[model samples]
Target: MKCVVSGGNIKILARAIQMLSKIGEEMFVQPQEDSLSFRSVNGSNSSFADITFHENYFSYYAYEDLDESDSLKCKILIRSALTVFKIPSLINKQIETCHIQLDANSTNLCFILKYKNNIIKTHLLPILDCETIRANYKKEGTVNHLCIQPRVLNDVVQNFQQNLLEITIEVLKDKILLRNYIDETSNLSNETRTQLVFGMGEFDEYKINSNTTITFCLKELRAILHFAEILAQPIHIHFDCAGRPIVFICKTLGVESNLVLATLNPDDDLGSQSTTHTRPNSVLKNSAKKPTKAKGKIKSLSKTVFGKLANKYPTNTNTEKIESSDKISNASETSSPNNNNKFNATNSPRVNSAKVIASNSNTNKRENDNSSKQNAFSSLLKRKSNQEIHSPDGGDKDDLVQNSPPKQPSKKAKLIFKKCFQTTFNPESLPGYNNIEVEDSGESD
Candidate 1:
């Protein structure tokens, strides 16, 4: 089975993966003729997320289902997916189309990234058994429904203390209150508690059958909010108290998406709180000023906004066919570029991919193979895309990891990666990309 994702859609998928990866390590991929879906659930089952990108989301769409295989299903380490999509800037400005091909006969999942210069890099991703995250949340029982702007909620959550584990949310008749979550094991210290209250004017709707209050993990909420902020959309929250999970549904009015995030409520012990109606004028009497809304600095990918900003380029033509691993393993094509895809980077700047590849290579100079150039380009494509990319929370994320740091690519490697990553353009076509000339190089050869 094969599916193509344009750079714009790739950015959307990348955002979804970045958000979901915050909660789970494995991602379930389900592909259909109409759309492609990605799902994930945290290890403790405390959170679940799903994102769908429809056919129009990609410039090209193709699906072939066999009687034996009704659909395409595979699971990959979210870490790998994140590594692959680490840079939104690259997908937006440098890369054009991303082709995903799944062969039932093979173990590795293949991704052929077509860039602006008619240059193509192929990545083989490892996979896990098929697994889907299913949410059995009951809708009828939901007692509270909130429609708040992502920015508003994001502002409120930002005021929360960094050390706080969770935030208590109270839905009332006139406003919503977000305060430091306090439990039986928690302290009532005025110096530690923080609170922010937003009137109905801050949200589109704040319907509450009852004055319900619940607390959810602050970090997780922040992560979800980042997704919403990126989309610049409203957040629809539905929940029934502190036992069942809370559901966050977000949508982009003009974009194709059905992004939903679910996080289980804290134990019932935290549920039994002082009713909002009975509580005094304020929930917390903290000396700290009312949680002030602050817009934290957001780190940018490549300053290249995500969208359809260029033309499409195909993977290969009959003349310069890219052979599959199962056949002609040793054959090397004359460094010629194959132009077949829909978008072209005729306007994007060109860089020396062969040189970039060489610096990103981890193999010894004496061992460079014909494939080394190919590996270098592909690896640099992935590595450079990650450079300067930030986490959902505005933190500078490590080169290729969520929490841990990636090994520093050698200085040569950094220079290689930067050359391709740092260019801005009056777009130009890479005329000789398809007919590449490789310098003779060994061991792996």
Candidate 2:
């Protein structure tokens, strides 16, 4: 039966076969097909050749001119080549198993390529499939012609290239994952942006990414790269988590870079510790102990000795002391008998002296007492005088009511009135009234 296979390059097919061998397959190559309509020639049998051509000057001609072993080997080589070159397409097609069979008679050679469950299967070829070959030949002069085009081959190669690109992306992803892993494993706390210092000098800090001298393992290098890639910004490194500086930078202020050197030595003493203008040793020593009074002992001694001496003297004298007997003697001498006798004789009383003295004293006392009483009375009278002088006119009526005795109305008033009156008359014409008026008028005329 006749068959066609198109678009397979011999070079590509050879490379595919070599690759298949690496994956544990054995294959043998046959001579390239020409213009001949070859027929099979077994010792006593004849068979027609199975002839096929691919798109790229590639042909496969199988016939009984060779032994059965050679035919089977040829089939194996062809299948192997197809598999390697069409790997991408096969994967895409999800074909898994492939089977091949070939048969040879003296005048004809027949081959069948069958798929099991649409999966590619593998085996040595050149097995007889007489019934299938006859059926194929009767229907059409050829059976199962498969063609491969340049475009199709290019598409398969492109698919493989795309897969390779995907693998590269996965690798990059894994690198990022590894970087994060290293960071987590390092267990370093977050470093702050600012640094604080108590002293003066250069500070010792870690160089996260900028120090060329500091060798980084794969993990750390990946971490730094990942940080730069993802954050797209620079990060600062401090001395430690607390962010204190070991030594202050002498140059530009507030400029922080990742470059780091050695730690500042404790002995560097750049004099920042003297900011308070105090001696370091003195300050430290004073802080170490409790304060005490410098003259405590002197104060206690003075108090004890002077306090005792002051208490002994009445006037709290610190220098002089007198005995009790001496004080008593001085008191007696001041009150001697002779002095007392003289005082008594000079002050002897005369006759009635006591009375006179008593009278004079009494008189003086009485005068004083009188003067005092008069003064008191005068003050009382002056107070009353002031009241009378300053009082209103109606005050006399109040005084009358207070001082005068109340009187009853007398009945003699009516009797006297009755006796004295001659009549109760109105004097309409008086004797001198008209005469006085006329005389006054005559004088005026």
Per-residue alpha-carbon lDDT of candidate 2 for residues 1-445, written as tens digits (9 for 90 to 100): 2232322222322233333233222232222222111111111111111122222332333333343422322223334344434453343234322212234432222222233355443433432222110000111111111112223222222332221211000011111000110111121223111111111112122222211111011222122222222222333322211001111111112111111111111111110111122232434323211111111221222233223322322122112221222232244334544322221221221121122110011112222334467664565566455532222222222111121122337667876676446575434454564454434345555
Poorest stretch of ten by lDDT in candidate 1: 293-302
lDDT tens digits, residues 246-345, model 1? 6777766323323322222222223323323321222321111111100000001011111111112111211232232112212322132222111112
TM-score of candidate 1 on Cα atoms, chains taken together:
0.57
Q: Distance from true position, residue 213, model 1, in Å?
A: 0.6
Q: TM-score winner among the candidates? A: 1
After best superposition, candidate 1 residue 321: deviation in angstroms?
Answer: 38
- The deviation in Å at residue 102 for candidate 1 is 2.2
Under the 3 Å rule for N, CA and C atoms, how many clashes does model 2 have?
23
Which candidate gets the maximum lDDT versus the true structure?
A: 1
Task: For model 2, give the RMSD to the true fold.
Answer: 62.2
lDDT values, one for every candidate? 0.53, 0.23
